[model samples]
Target: MKLSRFGGILSAFTATMALGLSGAGAATAATPQARATGYVALGDSYSAGVGAGSYDSASGSCKRSTKAYPALWAAANSVSSFTFSACSGARTGDVLSKQLGALNSSTGLVSITVGGNDAGFADTMKVCATDTESACLTRVAQARTYIQGTLPGKLDQVYNAISGKAAAARVVVLGYPHIYKLGGTCIGLSEKVRTAINAAADDINTVTAKRAADHGFAFGDVNTTFAGHELCSGSPWLHSITLPVDESYHPTAAGQSGGYLPVLRSAA
Candidate 1:
């Protein structure tokens, strides 16, 4: 959903009509109410909408897209203000140093998708996709070790920082979708490799969900939402591969709208 600047004007008008405010009172009435529902989005490439395309030029290399789930959700909802701070290639440390500034006590809603980068998911997938199955499995093993061991503490740091900054906001930690169709096969990637990658995705989701719960944030589980639309499915939601490589394995625009947006909306 591409939101125009006029969308805010229309929202203000609608709010005025809803309140039955007329004359001078109508102008002042809608502004404050709209501004009160502040929303901030923070995380990595997944949150920044890397594979969805139509990247926001003003957002620079961060590649924030209007088609991204967070932007779509913001456009569809009646929020007073929204800040999208997610950037491509962002790790937990990047978020701590850069994104958390967008959050504050007045923030009403927050959403994030992270930890894959920390677990070296892209590198692991590269090995699996371009190298031997044995090598890929070895990489997967390394990723799982990192996910189970080091990733949790890093996730907790980011989660705690988010909770601290947006004390009053409802934080929604989103999980990554599986890269392969369950019990299915695709070109280039063997079933065994696919299973291993999916298992890694599961590990990331499991830890993310538990950490979110510990921090008292809602975990938006997209696994079931993406059930029949994995990378190798007849109609896949996620992009299997792309020209730039960085775009590979990310959710497509349709995936952002149909897969992630609805789940996040429900949680919000």
Candidate 2:
């Protein structure tokens, strides 16, 4: 009877040890990689998600949205510690002073979307409306030149400022997503205007990409990633001008999910 009791105890102990080993192996296999730490977002209304998303009442701006790209990126990636300093009217200068404050050595990621405000693209569109294609084209060309010359240096400032504050953090500067496509048209637009705007956007992205590269930051080209989903195509990524005007030019919820999330994931 004593020998039988001892054998039973020995079998149970062996089984417990085997289970522990298996559990440890499974944990090792399932462990998620320790990615970079806190995520910091900076920029303008595009980053803010002004017109088409849920605003955070606590953020003290019509600009800050809970559904904005930064928020979405953070949620999707399970990044709990995030600092989003984006505001609706933010410009290049705005970022250097205000946004850089949120970054520190513990920060792992920084994402920015600027230059549109500096170029005054929104104001130009407001003035030109959809009817004045020639004026629109002219304004776009002038803005392109200004951006090409001025934006690179400003981008360098943003990069340097961020690096200064958060030496180990990876900086990512996102390009504008395509709001217009070749031969596309809106309620007040002709095909000519659409082509010109699309071309100008491409030029803007080119300058942004080059500047980001020079500054040793990652360039998130959401423009190329969203090539087929421009507003005129009836795609959900961008809003068409005639009907849900608020969402026009800005990225849609789908855009944030599909377009921007990939960039954040890659940055990590």
Candidate 3:
């Protein structure tokens, strides 16, 4: 595992927040409710809101987007304190070593979207997009094997640590959406490759959902939330091949707000 490289419409985007990440500070008000809840967001690029634009420059390569769900939630709900520790290219070990320090007894809520990097999600997509169909399937099959065999234990370890440090926190674990719309008329790649890529997403969600339940944490299934909005669906919230290489395959700001936000909202 390694930290690797990893949005939306104009009118739909939220104003960027001055995220105080990996440190303690009072968040700007967006709600009238008492901002007493301590919230710490942790996980991979998805959690850090990479695909979504308006990233906080302070996050540097981590690309912590102000449009990310954690920042959006904190703003809308008026949390007392917020910490954005999820980083781009983060793996399970990275979560344990880098992100977990923000958690404590005072933490009221936690949310994460990890395990993709461990499964080589970004690399897998790269192979599928640029390489041959057979090569794409091979890479996907490899990811599936790793997802099924090794990812569970790594996830368990992270979940256990989250609970250990933030005993009373309501942890919400979010999963990825299928990148492509199945059986659609997307050019370049065949349906078989598209389906395989989606299957990888499903595998990750299945394992992640089970492990989240095992730890008494809520699993937010974004597939259902992202239904009819995949790449070939004509109204994709998730991005396809795009500029700034890392943004590819990740959700647009529209996906973050319209797709991921509601899922995290109801789950949290």
lDDT of the candidates, in the order given: 0.90, 0.77, 0.90
Kindly report which residue stretches of model 1 are placed more than 4 angstroms away from their true locations once superposed: 1-36
lDDT of 1 by residue, 25-141 (tens): 767775654333789999999999999999999999999999999999999888878999999999999999999887877799999999999999889988888889999999999
Compare candidates 1 and 2 on lDDT and give the better one: 1
Each model's TM-score? Answer: 0.86, 0.80, 0.86
Residue 33 of model 2 has an lDDT of: 58
Per-residue lDDT tens digits of candidate 3, residues 1-268? 1323113332233323223331223433433444237899999999899899998999999999999988999899867689999999999999999999978877889999999999999999999889999999999999999999999999999999999999888999999999999884898789999989889999999999999998999999988779999998999998888899999999989889988999999988
User: How would you encode candidate 2's per-residue C-alpha lDDT over 154-240 as one tens digit per residue?
Assistant: 777877787889877888888887676656456567777777677767777898889888878888888656878876676748765
Model 2 is weakest, by summed lDDT over 10 consecutive residues, at 239-248
Native-to-model Cα distance after best TM-score fit, residue 134 in candidate 2, in Å: 2.0
The regions of model 3 sitting more than 4 angstroms off are: 1-36
Order by lDDT, highest first: 1, 3, 2
Clashing pairs in 3: 4-89, 6-246, 7-252, 7-253, 8-253
Candidates 2 and 3 compared by lDDT, better number:
3
